[model samples]
Target: MLKQKSGPSRRKVILIGLDSAPPELLLERFLDKMPTIRRLVKNGISGRMRSCDPPITVPAWMVMMTGMDPGQLGIYGFRNRKGWSYSDYYLTTSTMIKEKPIWEIIAQTAGMKSCLIGVPPSYPVRPIMGNLISCFLTPGLEKEYTYPHELRDEVAEIVGEYEFDAAFRSDNRDEILEAIRRMTNKRFDLANYMIEQKEWSFFMLVEIGLDRLHHTFWKYFDDTHPRFESGNRFEMVLEDYYILLDKRIGELIENCGEDTIIIIASDHGSKAMKGAFCINEWLIREGYLKLAERPEGIVSIEDASVDWDKTKAWGWGGYYSRIFFNVKGREDKGILTKEPGGDLDELVTELKEKITRLVDNRGVPMKNTVFSPDELYKTVRGDPPDLMVYLDDLNWRAAGTIGHGKIYLEENDTGPDDSVHSMDGVFILYDPRERIRKDIGTMSIMDAAPTILRRIGLSIPKEMIGKPV
Candidate 1:
């Protein structure tokens, strides 16, 4: 997707990602509140980006930064299922990534240094040009103080007394709040210190707070929920957070020299997903699947858990589900040659359509589309799941292509789950006309890297999925 161009690049680019930040929240509403973001938008080019197909965090981020598809990055969805294989959650730096990342390109070609703080799945740091301090969804962190012969005192000061490891998955709100405060403090300290110490070419920071809040509180903030929180519900909460988040961003930009370029982008927007669809269960009910042990009719899912060795596939977590084709060689005890077939594709398409056509428990039709690897992929190297299913505004889907059947529709989907991710990610750019930034349509989980590079005067790599903006 590289179209070579000649141009003057900014010496310094600061890309701040407000994870799951929706453009609506920032359009004149939270500008005063999110001073930093507001300032960046005002001083730079800004726009609303529509995320790619199956707009989950992992794939979406990959799309935004590298401009590559999920098929290329090998990051299919929230968790990937490989046939009778167990599903594994995706964290950025996980061994699952299959393509060239934007960081490598920036460091290798741009002749610039970067400071990346707390971008998800970036923890087990890989080869890169700058210092990377990572956390898992802002909850799990390795304090610089813990590093061998660490500068414990200095790192502590920079990270502040608070450190948030709050994940949307965590059931505890107290812990979540504490983690958020800590994470925010650490993000602030890290960005500030990095800018001061390093003549950084790009300083990229992503705020995971908004995303977390949406996941945990969407139910309390939406009209459908009897427990919807806040008198203003989700909309007002967004504004409040924007105002608070803005001040932090403002401070970061305040210290920057006029020559420095600051850009703000989100991996993808958020939407509410309350209904749950366990594709694996649906397959079993349809007789497409069989299990050795069904767990005495079901008390709780844990009680009814199937024999992983017996079932063809299963899925869980978040607003999506993965359907695995039980093929041999690919699975622990696979049955087929693991070849891709038209049958497999068609079956998935049918199931996906059925899932999309579903009405929520409240009887509302889901709105979304399914993307095969080719469809999800725009680049030669696509990072898509075996099959990708994008859901409606309030409904999302996940699937795994690890089975042998042409169509292994589940008899039951995971139970009716409440809440979904947010749809409000932000994008503010300086000189976005850069070849790297020109095609950026929407933000995703993967965009932070290359965008950071472009801001710092680095050219995106030919092999990488995304380029600098």
Candidate 2:
């Protein structure tokens, strides 16, 4: 285990997580506008941190904080399958996270306290050594959103009716922009208050507004987007928001004092969504999945009348595709054999070959990538999909809806979304006392937990796959 040099005083670490922040945006394009972040980069180590495979928000953030892979955590995305039941799925929550996060480990080993806010899967708030505020996943203010129960009242007293997230998918751009600003302002105000009032050895807060903004306004800002309009009304929206975020970050830095080590990170990056790949439609075309009758309009796979007895495989879609096989003795309407040399293996191989060679709407061969659960992680757990697929290097989202009559969609099936998640996110580690001015290049998302533990003078746990950077 790597260790930090022993200092005279106890070290405190503060992490500001900007969801869906990309190196292309934060570290390059808007770096000049973000003075505070730029200053940190000049003084410390900053780089493109490679996010995990199938990088969705929930599992990515959790993976960074726990030094574990999605496989080890048994969390694939925001929603996961409950078991072999075809339509039974569960949204990921704090109750599902079994691994000890960095804050929990510090609280257990060093008796250190942490102040956490808006960490994903942090809903249904559990008791911790210090203060806690739930993430966007929280149902509403009616539910207990803070740890210690009473912290909720204090939070309400400060930022009345705290905004967990914005309705970014709405068609009204102006309303969404205002809502995002309000949510961000309230979150940062609460964060500054916690910095002043809470006793914490570790502090972390994830601002989800950035992610929302990216998904909503990406097409307006990015000229490379297929739908980009040169003089769009919201063209400068992202720049203004980044500047506002920088100002908020400056405030947090001012409140945390010089002794604190500040780290800015993101779970995953954002990029212009090329389009949506109708995964289920493609499956139907390939004869892997069969429906009782084709729907007249677009509908979710779950709602569609599927011919399960004839279906060999089906898929769920989001940033990536989760394909499940109807294997014998596993699924309710099992068809394929599970044996190594059986029909299941043969089908999987065939699907892999065909899916990877699939072409886009323009008849151009797509750069599709596929992975099996067993091959992707150290230990596969939970009701994992038979295959995890990244469509066209993640530029195209996997659309689960069917009855579109075509495979490619210009817009999201669920809602309006301009951007998709990418593999490279930004990471900046700044220690005011030590102006190292070193560029560490690319680091793994899992390295964050061990690195934080090492900096705080704690032994790295054996289970952590990443070494301290």
Error of 2 at 372 (Å): 0.3
Give me the runs in candidate 2 sitting further than 4 Å from their true place: 1-9
Q: TM-scores, in order shown?
A: 0.75, 0.98
In the range 313-431, model 2's lDDT, one tens digit per residue, is 99998999999999889999899998888999899899999999998889989899999988989998776888999998999999999999998999999889999999999889998
Candidate 1 lDDT, 1-469, residue by residue in tens:
9522213554667777777776765645456666555545555656666565555666666566566666666665655543233443334443455554555555556455666765555545444566666544434444332212243355566765535445545557556655665677677777777777755566777777777766655565456544455564244544555666777777787776666666777766665554445454556666545655554433322234445454444434345444455445565665434347744445565666765675544566667555556654654242234544444553543322223122222211233223455444566776534313232455444454566554555555665554443
For candidate 1, what is the TM-score?
A: 0.75
Best by TM-score: 2
Residue 2 accuracy (lDDT) in model 1: 57
Error of 2 at 118 (Å): 0.3
Cα shift from native, residue 11, model 2 (Å)? 0.7
